[model samples]
Target: MLAAVFHENGGPEVIRVEEMDAPRPGPAEVRIRVEASSMNHLDLWMRRGLPIEIPMPHIGGSDIVGTVEKCGAGTVRSLLGKRVVVDPSLDYDWYRLARLRGYDGEPFRVIGEHTQGGFAEFAVVPAANVVELPDGFPAETAAAAALAGVTAWRGLMTRGGLRKGDRVLITGASGGVSAMAVQFANEAGAEVFAVTSGSENVRHVRGLGADHVFDRTTTDWGREIHRITNKRGVDLCLDSVGEAIWPQLLRALAVRGRLVSFGATTGPAAKVDIRLLFWRQLSILGSTMGTPAEFRDAMDMVFRGKITPPIHAVLPLHEARRAHEMLEAGEVFGKLVLDPREARP
Candidate 1:
């Protein structure tokens, strides 16, 4: 077996493809022959080194679509030979208790960030994490949808309280999660506003059902949305860009409106105006990945064809370094997939 891994973190160039021993499933786990895996911004963060400890020579990928090749002790035998997509959000005992109590648990950390992930010929996960894929479904598409789709669904519907006829604003609309947020909000009958880095991304974001697309390079999107909505502002705003645009998002929200954020791609520090927060009576909510129920609901819509995330490119596993470069440079509009079967001999 071969895996794309980095012994030490710094940049994309640190990632390399090397022959490695295949992983085996543990009790209650299943081994997946990874067909396709997708990249998330988390990958970039991990590669650049976060504060958490990582296993040396770590493989970083969270969104995985694969076939069950073997089942380990106490695993359900029926899952063997099935094609499935793994929910990258690992669950814990306290998480279930928190969900039952209607609170968000400090979630078990993400797969690739804290555990070995799917950038390999084979990976192991708890069998309970696998979601069966319908026959003939494109594995690459499922892989692309796994993390971003779930994150958007939870951010907008669960945290943002998005509903039909709501006016929604999504910042950094060209990335995977933000693009999915646009489509999901649109399908829910919201009037969707989007912000992108340039004219090229504006066109792409518009194609994803954004009612209006503003180029961040030239437009003050907050003011534009404010004017467009006749000073009422948007009912909801979903932001992933973090510090770079948080202040603007505050100005773009309607009175008592909610802003749900899942990531801080542009660095975490942000300056907030205390007056605007109190005067508007706004809700600024933080969200990470979805709860188990939310994950199921989101993937159900995905597997049923209600939403399909765009795939910017499908590269071989050996090109993982180049893929990371593209993602880090903000050159991709959607998910970049890796086919482990394409690894060199």
Candidate 2:
């Protein structure tokens, strides 16, 4: 099996493609022969180093779609040879109780963060993490859409309490999660507003069903959103670009509105006025990856074609470094997929 491994944290040059042993399934786990994997901002963050130190020679990728090759003892034997996608969120011991009752628990662990992930020919995961893919669903499409779609669904529906007739504003319109957020909000019968970096992406966001698109490069998008809403402000603001947009996002939120966040693409530190929170009675919620139940509900929509994933580019698996570069440089409009079958030697 060939996998992309990085021994040091730095730039793309640190990532190397080399042969590695295929993983085997443990009890309660399944071994998957990976067909496709997708890149996420989390991949870039891990590669560049975060506050925590990752093990040396790490393989990074979370979104995976593949076929089940083997099931460990006690696993469902009926799942072998089936096409599947993984729910990468790992539950803790205490959280197991919540999981058994179909409720989510805190302190969730994401795959590729605390453990090995699907950047190679074979990866192993708990049987509970696997979801069967519908017939005719492409592996690459499922891999590309899984994480982002689930994230958007959890952010809008679970955390933000998005409802029909609500006005939702999403920052960074062309990114994978933002694009999904737009579509999900629109499908929920909300008026969608998208803030994109350039004119080139305005049409793309609109096509995703955003009712209003603002060019963030040359416009005060928050002000534009306020004007569009007649100064009432948007009911919800999904902002992942932390520091650069926090103040503006605060201004764009309607009174008693909620702002849901998942990442900080534009630096983490922000100086926000305390008065804004109290006076507006705004709620700030932080969300991570979806729970198993949320992932299932979200993927159902994708499998049924209720929402579509936008593929920016598909590259060979060995080109993981270039994919990271593209994401870090913000050159992609949506998810970038890596086809393991096409990986270079």
Candidate 2 lDDT by residue in tens digits, 313-338: 98998788899888888899988998
| Model 2: residues with Cα > 4 Å off, grouped in runs | 92-107
Candidate 2 lDDT for residue 233: 96
- Indicate the residue-level lDDT of 62 in model 2: 86
User: Taking the tens digit of each residue's C-alpha lDDT, what string does model 1 give over 180-226?
Assistant: 89999999999999999888899999999999999989987778887
* Candidate 1: regions farther than 4 A off: 92-107
- Give the clashing residue pairs of candidate 1, or none: none
Report lDDT (CA) for all predictions: 0.90, 0.87
